[model samples]
Target: MKKKRSIISLCLSALFSLMLLFTSFVKPVNAAPTITLEQTFTATANPDVVGKWSEVERLRVNDTNITQELFITDNEHKTSTIVKGFGNDASPNSQLFLLHKFAGWNTATKPYPVLFVHGAGSDGDFAVDPERNGTTPGLAQSLAADGYAVFAITFAHPHGDNYIQREVLAAAIQRIKDITGKTKVDLIAHSKGNMSSRMYVSDVKKSWGTAFRNDVRRYIQLGAPNGGIDYTFRNTWAAWGIMATGAFGPVPYTYMTIYGWPTDTAYHSIYSAADGGGAYPGQAQMLARWDNVYDLDIFEQDWYTTYYGGWGYYSYSEGIDYAINQGGNLINTLKNTPVKSTVQLATLAGSENVINGVVMEDDGPSDGVVFIASATMTDPMISGGATLLEKKVLPINHVQLAYDPTALTWIKTQLSR
Candidate 1:
């Protein structure tokens, strides 16, 4: 009997050994990599210098350098270059700044820290904390002065891919949570910044992206083109304006025949799938026709040919519809995918169509650039699961939404709740 028992115990020990060996060979699935912290420093805004980080006041910001391993791919999403930060020419992979006001603060009245995401062609420092010597304070400064910890992220490319920007935003939220010892943070995204923030909140991401971990408390969007926009396509002259200034991304129209410039068909053409999908994936993703609802501005030169597609007197265009197709119709994707039910959502739209003195988007109610309907469109979010805290329309233009006193007051009111 003793001999038989010994043999049975030996068999059990061998089975246990096999189990251990098998488990060692299997890797964990969908595990997030540790976000590396490069360094942390206090940044002071230099008023004399006119550039990215020089806009914000020195006393209000404590900048931290953080890195996220990103799969940087071309416009087509084919081949990827593994980058430590947002890998692009605008800002290097090493200099992705996460600006916050936590270290300098003495107390906290708010439960969660506010994370600010800037719009297209803008950085966090300039977007939230612009250099304005006036009685009115920017959103970031107001929030911080009221005893709330504020944080903002600056992307490598101001007009970088939303797919990559979404991942960058997720990393920023994680870093903020870690520093504050909080479970969640409040998110405030403006203009194009809303695209990445919404993508992160809805878990609507590329296959490489991490799922939404329910880390946001209040998701507030200011002057967001939530339903998407077709400003460049609708206003063909605007495309020229962009190309002339070398600001923003590539427009659908080519300036070859009109300006005697060589044709960059790959970058300028709507059909070209060359450079990471096209010269500007971020701008392309926000393409959608509002012409069906609002009349195209007839005042502009060659509005007919620009809208329909063909050689205009000035330039050539593939039309807005073709541009939307080339853009991958990202608006439809976001419309289908809803944010998690736990997050409370809010939207603020600018009703005033006149920006500075120019009447823009006159056919429809717009904040100069974005339509009110597009900005206030939250039915999809509410229907999916998120509770709508509020949807407000302020008498301000697109640019003033971030700095106007009234808008700032409304934002403060929402954050207080």
Candidate 2:
């Protein structure tokens, strides 16, 4: 009887050991619920082009920086709205794309409001994950799920001129103020959005005096072409064609003076006194017929064109043409933009990144659109003598920089502060 009892006890111990091993091998399931949306606006697949330009092929849900652990499902929290801009000649594209928590400004539990300004060629919806596979969500939507008052801006034209875009953004800011009852909101700008935001804070806000100053608390610049990019010149013909059509608007003049390669009209390489007083060796000229331009107004009434050796000469012609045909006042409106932000500033640079479809030669470690140095605002000139509260340089490309996990984490941390 004693032998039989001991054998039974041994059998029970063996069973317990097997159960422990099985449990140890099994991975724990995530406790957080996967969020599903009633509607999703993901980027469409680019059928015409190759190399991941399309919405379907480019960004991956798993590739995003957001982790399942931090993900939360909130059907009642996500909402979108279309706010019309105050532009006198505004088109349908002037409407701002707004996405936020359904509770919106009325929610007492949410933190400060955040405004996201998208880059050129895209609107506020750019942050939204086009892949509705339940794993990927838009940046603004994610922030909303995280219990924050987040708003995004999309213009009527989608590719509207920067001046017009700026006006639209100004109106958007006022709307955000009205809805949230918050006096000031934080800004997260990408690409040309950075220039747009900077123009508003440095120049446009001055027009409003103290009210504008009080309206902005923090500004985050991601992959900003603050120092300008040579990509425009590298593809000279396309650049010329786009300029002639006034696709990018008068802001190109400003970009030329700030960051263009030193080249005179007729595409001859020259020594530029503006670019840290150094000569670019083996710099390819953009246009053979391009000549030195006179009366280039980068700043208001200040015709300084010696920068980049005379790169302005070529760009100024485009600006002049834009001013003459499309709208001269537009060119005048974008000149000599001063830089000053009353709020705290942070910069994130995507370095060593390239896109699948782009063809322009990289000047340095760039995110396939803007260089890392430009995104970081390391140039003393573009930084406007203001010190950045934080700066990060990451190895990521232009399109995904804002959505990158590293960027989102830092942004979350900063917003918490």
Candidate 3:
């Protein structure tokens, strides 16, 4: 009897402990930290948005093949250049390449070079296929070849708003800045890279104070999600959402963004240079605009937001808890999101395979991996990542925004400023 009682007590204690642990890492409340509702805020997207946005398909023969070839001439006005890079992959033995372009190489009044942050699931390498119709290899390389130095940045793994990936991105940016002596760099980040770029720059300021802010001349985030995204499918949403609301809990870095919905805690705080897709009252207005497939609606249903203390908008369900309970392999829900139905066709419609010189497989969706919403920015610029000038948006995807011809025209207009 005594032994049975002891074992029973032990079992009860263990159960209690597990319960406490789960409760400790609950989801955050849906209330905004700070909110300035622009009752006038309306969607400015066009109806022809369908015509402009392309479809993505799957990969073909050239999609996975690796290559390394030398250039024949010194055509400085090149749009893009591809080479191998450092990273690992899921395949047994796989390798990847890096892409770069030097913009404004010789111009005296050259605008500070802007690094293109491609979307998720893809590196800077366009040698394979263009998941999105707007990835302009010609214009990007030409910008580099023409005089402006341009580089398309890619991480070893997926990192679309996922916590650890952001850290790696921060380190990656620093390394790039170190390699290139250009004092002030202009960043043009797409999709998840936008958030990653913002976090890195913010870290530079926090770690070294505002001194580093000057090192950034201009910062543009294309297809950025100011609010929480469609958290429906992923089990990791609840926990990550909780960590993202505050200054830096799960991500452990500064968040330069504006939440779009009242339910999102980020909507409460406007840490980004621009809030909700328009010019700031202070400076840098008049940027062009872009759009993504879905809004922040998929994950709209309320759950038992643990932090809120009950069944609320940000609750942690058994699904999420099971995924991350008792210290799991912290999955990056942001980057690994499956291809959403809305934008699936557009991501792969037109890409051709470089190898065997035939049409490649349709890419499906993604600049590489991150979704369309996370890559959009409907706002203007402010005083944070350097300069107090007007802001503008270009009708392009995240990566394409940096090097697309139309976007380049808009950038040149900014340069004249």
The per-model lDDT (C-alpha) reads 0.68, 0.47, 0.33
The prediction achieving the highest TM-score against the true structure is 1
Q: 1 or 2: which has the higher TM-score? A: 1
Best-to-worst ranking by lDDT: 1, 2, 3
lDDT of 3 by residue, 1-417 (tens): 999999999999999999999989995432211111111111133212111112111111121222221111121112221111231122111112222333333342455655666644444543122433454354345455446656554443332223333343333344445556566666665544554555444432122221223355555554444222222222124234533443211210122222433243322211121322111110011011111333222343332332112234433222223212211222232222322111100011101112222111112222322233333322221222233333343334344544556655655454334
| Candidate 2 total steric clashes | 18
Q: For each candidate, C-alpha RMSD in Å?
A: 6.9, 24.1, 22.0
Alpha-carbon shift of residue 155 in model 2 (angstroms): 1.2
Task: Report the lDDT of model 2 for residue 188.
Answer: 90
Worst 10 residues of 1 by lDDT: 76-85
In candidate 2, stretches whose alpha carbon ends up further than 4 angstroms from where it belongs are 1-105, 108-110, 130-135, 204-211, 236-341, 378-387
Give the number of colliding residue pairs in candidate 1: 6
Top lDDT: which candidate number?
A: 1
RMSD of 3: 22.0
